[model samples]
Target chain A: MTILASLLKRDLGRFLPGTSSGGTMLPLLFFLAVAMLYPFAVGPNPTLLAATGGGVIWVAALLAAILPLDRLLASDVHEGFFDQWALRGISEEVVVAVRLLAHWLSFGPFIMLAALPASALVGIDGETLRIVELGLLAGTPGLAAIGIIIAAITVGLRSGGAALSGLLVIPLAVPLLIFGAGALSTGGDGGLALTAAISLLLVAIAPFAGGAAIRAAREG
Target chain B: MEPFRLAARDIACRRGDRLLFARLSLALEAGQALQVSGANGIGKSSLIRILAGLARPFDGTVERAGTIGLLDERPALDNDQPLGKALSFWTALDREAAPLEQLGIASLLDVPVRYLSTGQRKRAALARLIGQQADIWLLDEPLNGLDVDAVKLCEELVAQHCAGGGIAVIASHQRFDLPGMSTLSLAEYAL
Candidate 1:
């Protein structure tokens, strides 16, 4: 438990925005920029904004998840933190699990908060805004999971890996986007429940998959 | 001071398609040290990795009886952090206070690690290694960027570690002065 706590502390300190490790507000800023720009692009028709705004938020959230992907595992793997942790008998799986949690915590709640103003900008109804908040809560964990997995797999690719990771995540994250955004249109609990289930599955598999990916990167 | 052992049996390492070395083996008991030397690209680092259990040999096996600590090219300290805070992360985990003054890095604690020179970073890494207090130390090119005094300090540190019943396997092309330390030239095992 102490080990986990210490690891969590280190990971959070490195990842949380405004920490000494240079964790940026880039993702949050990008997310809001998307919401802010959508109205101008579509000329601010209230009915049109209300109808399509939810999907725009979903797309923005997904894109925001990509902003931090490059830094997630690459720096740690390249800089030998993983090697030292391995030497100490801290399994890659444990580190990846802690990292996944940190990754989620860094962007998840903040994006949920950002969504409030985003909903206002996009002219979403109160009931729809509530669903968007709930959907983000259910869907962002899966986004974080997908981000970590791609980051670990691409950790060895050096220069172009960041762009490639973003591309890789889009395809993998289609399900979460569909279900989470699909809930807003269908006005149903079933979509949110399915989104949460998918998130749970991805979260469960991310640590093992990411652990193996990094170990392979190390040996290769 | 606990009993520790590191041994490799008929281990062969293949990087990509080429075999770097083959039919190599060595063993170290407590209070022993070995230095692996070779030309660049001759597999000294691979052999250290094999022994450290970080990479698998193409053939044969490695056996160990203690915690392993590795210091390679990467210092592993967080680049954006002050040296003190960066080192503290590990000291906190290892639960052992490093002798920063002895490593000549006590005064460098406030410097962010990215601004540190090669020698300072090397010394900081050494502090982390000493704090780890692992039974076996696998060092790859420990003296690459050190000055005369730092080089001598590194040699003395390794000697003290061995004298205290710890094991050290150093992979370096440069001279490493440690009495009674056997040298293994990887060229002899190169295929």
Candidate 2:
């Protein structure tokens, strides 16, 4: 627990005003702006909007959420933060756990917010919006977990771009997108149920995937 | 706190296509320091990684004791990170000097480390060692950028760490003088 606390603290501690982007708040606002622009850009077609709203919102959330991941571990892995975590003699599994959670908190919320305004473009109604939002809230952590594992693998490489992450990450995340949209399409209760099952599955998969990813990245 | 004793036999590391060092055998005991002297391209840092447990060598077993503190020439700081928060990466360190007090870098602690001068960043890395409470010190050109006083402070710290049964292994091109430190020139052992 001490190690977990310390690792968690260290992972989240990067957010201390001085450590990372002091202007991080701006990104959230940027997402909001982007989402709002979608409705106008796509033309307000209600039927077209509702059918696709769920998928568009999820993709946009993922796109925005994934933007910073490569950079996230890029800095720390090179800085020996990952190495120190390795040498701390703590379980690397726990470090991965802490890091994924922190990344979700930092990057995932903005994705949700980014998708919120864009939801209108797809013709999502009020209740659907709530379901999608709630579904997103529950499901985005899985995206972060998957994204982080992918990022950790690529961070040490000289060329760790979105292209590279796509190669390894797509297969693992299909369920997240599928069930994520399922929850919103079917209703909150349905989405909630799927999110629960998927979240549990993610917990099982995260440790192994994250562990391998960290090791592979560091070896590079 | 014998600077963690290192027990290694037949250790060899291959950095890439080339073998950095092979069939290497050495035992570093408490209160001892060994300088891993070699040319720049010979995998000095790679050896440090193996010792620090960050990398596993192609062959050989190594047993290291105590917390190992590594100070590479680069300091491994995130330029975007401030001095104080960046310091957290050195989890092995426990604080001994306030960021501002030791290197006159207190004001810059909040500044992105990338924006700082190379010398300033180096100081922050060294200061992190003071915080780590590490008994096994692996310094890869720790003297890169520092005034005479800071070098002396480092020497004193290493000496103290050794005096407390700690150990230090350093790799450097510059001349570093210390009493009773054993020297193993990688040149002499090169294949």
Candidate 3:
């Protein structure tokens, strides 16, 4: 529908790379920074690096997902965008759903692209790199979902919300982390499927949860 | 442009543990305007929001028969974007061009919204509201940051809107002059 398209276009503009509030490659850069620092901290131990690099990438991706949470829904809610939408007979669910897709598009693919060089920096092998990429592909949607749900919940908080959202995402993201990073160790497609399944579930539920959170925030 | 109506009955608003007001009621038919006036924290904005259906009344129901437009403290414009681009977003959604020149924001369209003065931002919000062209307008403190000329322009716009058979409910402590505009002092219903 045209409504959804317009909403997506606006969201992409606000959140896409290189925009002022959009995080503009900060998450990707942060992921690379984490990857680039691991080798130095571990003193160039190839075996140790290879063994832990995939997990490190997963952790970094999780953190990177949180980087944009503060901007995800807070600014719109604060500026009364949600209220305006509500008045127009547009449901919060639709807005949050569009936002979830936009949030994923803004960071998910870029993080996946950055993982190649990140693998090189962290000394992950070709086999591990393939699994890491695939696992991330399966997991990032869930990460984006977690970020949005938490962002909605924390949008009404004045102080410490960014930090609080980050903290809240960690525990909720553990399932994705376990399944995604587990794929690296197991070297099997089964873990990837499970990660994808979890991602699907999270994606399915994010819109409703986020929608309720936004409404509750308005009430508060 | 469709026939519009807004009605609230026995509406009560509670914020946190405190009751702001109780047993408030009003009705607006087409071509009618109401100004909600009260001191700060007297639920003027809350009353406007309750009528707009953005917030739930603690103990009543609101019935509305047309599309609603709300203007509040926030302009709902992207602060980082140029004013033209920001208004374009709403214009695209509303499928109508904003009256930028009429709102006196045509010259400042290239400026980032963050760099705009409060009055400029308010005018931009007015443009957005105009573009929406909703049948019912819920304006909360719409005169807060406008200059003398802008305030008069705002009154004229509202008057024109009401003359066109649209309904407007304005909530502000500042006196808003309009012919045949009914005023509601919220203090009467304060608990």
Best by DockQ: 1
CA lDDT, every model vs. true structure: 0.94, 0.71, 0.93
User: Chain B alone, TM-score of each model?
Assistant: 0.98, 0.85, 0.98
**lDDT at position A6, candidate 3:** 88
DockQ of 3: 0.75
Instruction: Write candidate 1's Cα lDDT for A1-220 as tens digits.
Output: 7789988998899889878678888899999999999999999699999999999999999999999998899999889999999999899999999999999999999999999999999999999999999999999999999999999999999899999999999999999999999999999999999999999999999999999999999899
**Interface RMSD to the true structure, each candidate:** 0.9, 3.4, 1.3
Report the CA-based lDDT of candidate 2 relative to the real structure.
Answer: 0.71
Kept native contacts, as fractions per model, are: 0.76, 0.26, 0.74
Which RMSD does model 3 reach against the true structure?
Answer: 1.2
Model 2 CA lDDT for position A168: 66
DockQ per candidate: 0.82, 0.40, 0.75
Which segments of candidate 3 are over 4 A away from where they belong? A20-22
| CA displacement after TM-score superposition, residue B41 of candidate 1 (Å) | 0.8
Candidate 3 per-residue C-alpha lDDT over B1-191 given as tens digits, one digit per residue, 9 for 90 to 100: 45689999999999889999999989999999999999999999889888988789999889999999999999999998899999998888899998888888899988999999999999999999999999999999999999999999999999999999999999999989999999999999999
In Å, residue A192's CA in model 2 sits off its true spot by 4.3
